[model samples]
Target chain A: MRKQHWIEVGVGAFMLFGIVALIFLALRVSGLTLDRNEPSFTLTASFSNIGGLKPRSKVTLAGVVVGRVTDIQLDTKWYEAKVTMSLEQKLEGLLSTDTSASILTAGLLGENYIGLTVGAETDVLEDGDEIRDTQSALVLEDLINKFLINSTKD
Target chain B: MIGLDSLARLGRAGLALMAALGRSGVLFFQAVWGWPSGQGVKLWMRQVHFIGVLSLIIIVVSGLFIGMVLGLQGYSILVGFGAEQALGQMVALSLVRELAPVVAALLFAGRAGSAVTAEIGLMKATEQLSSMEMIGVDPMRRIIAPRLYAGFVAMPLLTAIFAAVGILGGMLVGVDWLGVDEGSYWGTMQATVDFRADVINGMIKSVIFGLVVTWIAVFQGYDLVPTSEGISRATTKTVVYSSLAVLGLDFILTALMFGRI
Candidate 1:
């Protein structure tokens, strides 16, 4: 009877250990953050096309990640991808009203993200400020088409 | 006359193979149907102890060693390109996506699967199975079902433990042995790995592998020929077939899950 009870307890321990391991694996492999610790402020930007830009894509200034793009919506009137990003609160003084935002690719084949080039201006953009100066993603097909047209004419 | 005899022998082999497959299918369902009986609970517990609890140490030790090797190799390779910060991503992705499920299942088959086959084959050779049948006891329900069920239940959990332990092992080598920044190791991993793409699919792979390997192992045991040599041969076949099936299914399952097949 004691041996049977020990087996039962061992089985129970195995099951409990298994559950803990599974949860740990799930959290680790998913890249889900344990704490939402970054204090951030939201801003909007308009782009003609976002290409492969996603909601969780990084937002960078001078190649340093300062925020994450949170929401992307289609602007029906402008016919463009309107992106909402949340930046770290520390960048408020550094970015001006005239900052230029471009959808940039990381390396040759990396994921798409938002890159900011600061412009010279005294007025800092406030909360909910829409970035007006922007550049869209470069589509390879369109560039090829333009190149073909120019080459044929020449 | 010789040609006719060889053709007849080939036909008989084909018929026997089909008959074996059909009987295994019936045994699986019969066990499942008989699962609600009172003794079923006790039998399942015993099987789980045999299959799962006993196999824990080997699985954990192997997982750690594999992870350490991955860490050491990954660090060396990435050091060349100065992209060693991505070491966490490499280890986690490899473990969750492929290695953990496939390797652990292979090991399980060699250890638990061979044990299962030998036990069942011994019973058959000893005439215990025949005696049980004479007494009108359904041996499939009593013997085969619990073992099969326990395997299915225990496999995914074992696989998850393997992956987690492996990642932890990678951390030890990457952080302590190689002196990688601890924060970056975990941070890069968190930033890159996607839950649906890596973890869920990995767990699914492990479960399917468990089902396939266990099915082959139990079937090989239950259908063993009644002889000493036959019992030994069946045990060997269980290991061999389970390993082949796990690897082959992993390739097909991976393509289906990851590649748009």
Candidate 2:
């Protein structure tokens, strides 16, 4: 009975430690900020495809991340991918009415990110405004197939 | 005539083995599809509690050490090239893409996979599987399916734990030990690491590895001969085959995913 009790305790300790570790990890991944001072606004971008895109995916402009993708859904009427993004307060003035969103690759075979090409229009994009024009990512497989077909044709 | 007959018999045996493997593969898919309707969900919950919640400490401790070592080693290498700022990206990418899933799978195989083999092997030796069949209960659906589902579901969560701990470990080394700014470390990681496909690819691999490990364990255990030695052998085979399959499948997946990247 003593042996069994020790065994149970050992197992319990192992489980408790693991749970604590995982909780710590989840907190890290979520980037739970305590500051609460960082002002941010939301903007939406529509795409034909948003393959593998998820919430917390970084949003970049000119190779610098200014925000993150907060939510994604399929648009009902247009049958398109709708991605909602949150931008840092400092970047609010940078976005304009004519800003165009494009899906870009990080490396040769890296993950896809949404790149905002800030336009020169004087009208600044407000909170809740949708970026009208967007470009979807060129999937690797499609590009490879296209290359093969074109090369074969030549 | 005797030589020709022997050759024909050999060919028939080869064909039969192939047929068995094919059937096993089909059965695997059937088990997966039938999971929602079967008692698979209950088994899955038990497995998650056991494999995920239970094994959390080992995963975190191992993950933390792995991250620290990776940061130390990665920093040393990058320092040579004047690219120490790249450490965050290196650590995050490595943890998310490779170390987390593979390490989690290996550990799960040792902890839960061995238990699975032992449980099933004991049942087989005692003719419990046979008894279940006699009562019109399909052992594969009731027993094996749950284990497989549990493994498949638990792997990704375990991998997530690994990634989280690993990043924190790296952060500790980067910020506390190396004096790198926390903001810079996170900022670099966010900028350099491709989040979408890499995370998806890792999770997909975890699910596949989970399925393979569980299948191998159950298959070996259920087929164990009615002897102490046979049970031991089944346990050994389960670990060996599952590890090999995980490594082999990892290579294939890496090639398919990163080949174009």
Candidate 3:
């Protein structure tokens, strides 16, 4: 009986520990943030070349992450890449209408994210508003080709 | 005559393999047909204790060593390129997506799968299973079901623990010993490794491995020739077959989950 009791305790402990570990992995190890209660608003921008930008990529303002790219699609009408992002609602009226969005890489050969540069305007950007000025991602191959051509000419 | 005999032998081998697969499938359904009720819960608990709790020490020790080795290797390689901050991402992704499930399943096969096969094979060899049947208790229900269920429940949990410990071990090596920024190590990991895509997918892989390995173990044990030599052979088969099945199924599962099709 005593041995049986110990066995039960051991199983119980194992189960409990396993559950805790799973929760830890989900909350701490993975990119899942549990406290997403803070409301956010969506914004759209159009670019000529998104390069390798993917959904769930970060959107940064002044080197700090402010939003995430929620969707990326080809704008069939304009022949441009359309990117939709969600930003924290607290900064809703702070971004000017002339603010520019650019695709930037984290480091050389690293993941790509959208970076925002503030512009001089009184009107603030709101949800569903499109940023007029957008910079496309710099294509490394294109840059290399241009560099090689310029060096050869010189 | 020689050629004809060789062809006949190959055909017979193929037929026997198919028959064995069919039998294993049927036995798995039988084991999974019902819920644990009354004394069944106690039997399951005992099996869990035997299989899961006993296997914890090996899982943790191996997970830790493997993670530390990954950290060391990743640091050396990335340091050359000045990308040492990605070490945590590399270690976490590999452990969460591949190593934790595959290696843990392989170990579980060698440890618990073999033990279950041996125990059941010995019972059969000693005529204990027959005695249970003679007493009007179905040995399949009484002996096999609980063990199979215990394996199903234990494996994913064990695998989760393995991955969690492995990540911590990587942090120890990458951050403490290697002088990588502690903030960036964990921050990059948390930013990159998706819970749904990597972690949950790994859990799913372990669950499938557990089912297949346990099914193979119990089926091999129950269908043995009930001789001492047969018992030994079946035990060996359990480990060998389980490892192969885990590896093969991992490929299919990976292709299905991450293939974007």
> DockQ of all candidates, in order?
0.60, 0.10, 0.86
Candidate No. with top lDDT: 3
**Decreasing lDDT order of the candidates:** 3, 1, 2
Q: For model 2, name the residue pairs that clash.
A: A18-B56, A18-B57, A108-B261, A109-B261
lDDT of 2 by residue, B8-116 (tens): 9999999977976776687677666657454555555555566666677788799999999998898889788766777887888898789888998998888888889
Worst 10 residues of 3 chain B by lDDT: B28-37
Per-residue lDDT of B131 in model 3: 98
Rank list by DockQ: 3, 1, 2
Residue B161 error for model 2, in Å?
A: 0.2
Off by over 4 Å in 2: A1-154, B1-13, B33-41
lDDT (Cα, tens digit) per residue for candidate 3, span B134-228: 99998877889999999999999999999999999998899999999998998889998999999999999999999999999999999898999
Q: Which pairs clash (backbone N, Cα, C closer than 3 Å) in model 1? A: none
Candidate 1 per-residue lDDT over residues B155-214, each given as its tens digit? 998999999999999999999999988887888888887887788899899888888778
* Per-residue lDDT of B149 in model 1: 86
- Comparing 1 and 3 on TM-score, the stronger one: 3
By summed lDDT, which 10 consecutive residues of candidate 1 chain B come out lowest? B28-37
Q: RMSD per prediction, one decimal?
A: 5.3, 10.0, 1.5
Question: Highest DockQ, which number?
Answer: 3
CA deviation > 4 Å runs, candidate 1: A33-56, A59-101, A105-110, A115-132, A137-154, B1-9
